[model samples]
Target: MPDIREENKDIINCVLESMQGFVVTDLDGKIIFLNDRYADILQVDRHEVIGKDVIDVIPGTRMHIVARTGREEMGSLFKLKNGESVLVNRIPVRKNGKIIGVAAFGSLSMLDEMSTVATIQKIGHLSQELNQYKSELNKLRGAKYSLDQIIGNSPNLIKMKELIKKVAQTKSTVLITGETGTGKELVAHAIHQLSTRSHHSFGRLNCAAIPNDLLESELFGYEEGAFTGAKKGGKIGKFELANCGTLLLDEINQMPLYFQSKLLRVIQEKEIERVGGNKPIDIDVRLIFTTNRNLLDMVHQDSFREDLYYRINVMSIEVPPLRTRVDDIPFLVEHFISKINKELGLNITGIDDKVIELFQTYYWPGNIREMENTIERAANLALQGKLTLELFEHFLLRKEKERSRNENEICLETVRFKAEKETIIRVLAQTNANVSMAAKLLKINRSVLYEKIKKYDIRTM
Candidate 1:
């Protein structure tokens, strides 16, 4: 019987060694025996921890509960002195149906095997959060109308949105024509976002901004040494960058007449030839062109080609000027204020009613661009609370003065044209039959005024 009891004790010790930290405490909460693993986890020697008060080492309500209840508690997170989280399991030890002591096992926070299961759980939660965030980001990126991004309640703007949605699925050429500052570029971006090509690049070029000499190189690529200062390596242009995507040609009317022929060919053939190169590169591009100028009038005036105008004017979308959509001013102002507040990091709550009233009454010549600029300027100058009418008075007065000056100038020019035409005809009649004298008096080519004479139906008398 003595030998069997000793064997059982050895078996218990071996099993405790294989398991993590284990502690056996008597009913009085005194530590009777502690495993080497348990001592190592607490950073103390096994001999020093043995026969000590368990409450003195692990002082907490959990210890009192285990001593009183004699029940098992499993997998609870507890903070250690070093600020690491630990998982603990407590079991009541009994002999002959009477509870003698409590045995507890604890796993340290940093052990690799114990944390592997926890790490996988954390990673799975993070992956789920990432997927949800990606889905929300895509929705925001593709939205056309919202509270502060796009502002309009007018039927016209609603119609424009419907048309944009209708054409977003097709790979068609779009021509946006409107007065300057009417948000043509905004419409272009909305179309691209709604389309399948939203994942691809949306490249833009201002045709009027680039100089004529550089416009060709900007639209189509150039081989090395194509020009005097050409890059050593061949350059790829906007067309190639916009391939399999969308390209916005702003101020398309300002494209040089010479380049118009080349653009026309590219549009028709769906290919482009690099400058000084013979190879024609095929491109699958969706072209979106914008212009405030009337291309038909330009074609009639010989300033733009008729063929190119028709080619690019495939599906025309006319963006109405802000003056024609005055009912949207309130929504636009609120949107601008929200955008400005976010950008300036201000906590502005709202705009004054009187300030919105003034905006509704004002004629925005520069349209949305002018409105945004004005709002930005006011936001920078405003106090931390709100924007008031008094803060925008100076800007409003400035715009009023500019409008008055423009009107006066137009009147003066009209008077000047009548006076100049009268003087030229009189001078020509007085110096009649002498072409040199007539040219000298008019200070212009005799042929030039003669053409004007026929143009204005002013015969030489």
Candidate 2:
């Protein structure tokens, strides 16, 4: 007798895995095979259910009946235990004209599939739009920035740079964290520029910018006909494009938890399967993840995966916020002024010492990005001259006003004295300078009231 199960098991397994969700059962209707997607669809662990009866493992399933009757059930609406319905197709396996087993392929709800198709179309359109920059990106590939371009000399910054140099020589994944606009992305670029993969492309994706539905496709790519409106010939994802190079995933905290599990698998396996692809493609890209949020806090809250947190955190670089490293403001200011001067076709030779002092003292809530904008806006207004507080009088002067207000703030003692002095004067006038009566009304001793009057230099009526 021909044994189809053993004769082509490898080929069958490959085809089954490429499917979205699938389950295979033996002649007795006991589950013999299943894939991750199927387990995900059923919300159960694949390991726990293998060797179990299909009917018990999956609610409203007809795999056993199909296996015994050698019949095929197509386009069946299967209701899960959770009351959700999915479309599935079950077919009996055959060998030498005899029934052997049954395999069922399932898909997500029709509503979900429609939404996925819409998202694919939207991404396809965006991919088309981005194609215009493909040539420019190729020309500038791996030309982002070097370590010298970081432009800071604070002890914290020097230590971070030294760490970057040491980190660039390794192949370990790097985690970069800091407040938003703290130049974390620059550090990522610097690391990539100094690494051995500098000769290859450096790719970046902003996790916060991409929709959750589109993140997997954008990162792992997809094959043609992966969905209803998928792009023709498919589109390559960042992992493949940056193979043998570096990929920076910025704002990584925005990634959803479900997708974090998927990402964890990719990191561990060092390979990826396209959305509709059957074979896994090997990747050699180094990864650098940057985020403004605290991932450890997120892990504690269960918003981020704990395993992924520890995995990517093998090495970390915490970029110091601008407020903590205000010593760099002068150098940062000079650099931005010179850069903006050429861009604006102006000759801003220097900045006033007072203005620099204001910058150093001012809390840079927006960090380096805000500083650059401040200089650019002032540079635009000046056209050609030494940058001054007057140029930034509109916005930067608010800091000076805040400082003056703070300086002129009243202390508790002064407030108490003023209230007491005014109240004593009013009470004395009400009593026609009757010290005893005024003291009684004021709820204090006559001698104390008289002494307070003398101290405040008040003349009673």
Q: For every model in order, what is the number of clashing pairs?
A: 0, 0
lDDT tens per residue, model 2, 276-333: 9999999998999998998976775568998999989988999998888888888998
Give the top-scoring candidate (lDDT).
2
Tell me model 1's lDDT, rounded to 2 decimals.
0.78
Model 1 stretches astray by more than 4 angstroms: 1-148, 402-461
In model 2, what are the clashing residue pairs, if there are any?
none
Q: Distance from true position, residue 282, model 2, in Å?
A: 0.8
Per-candidate TM vs. native?
0.59, 0.58
Model 1, position 191, has a per-residue lDDT of 82
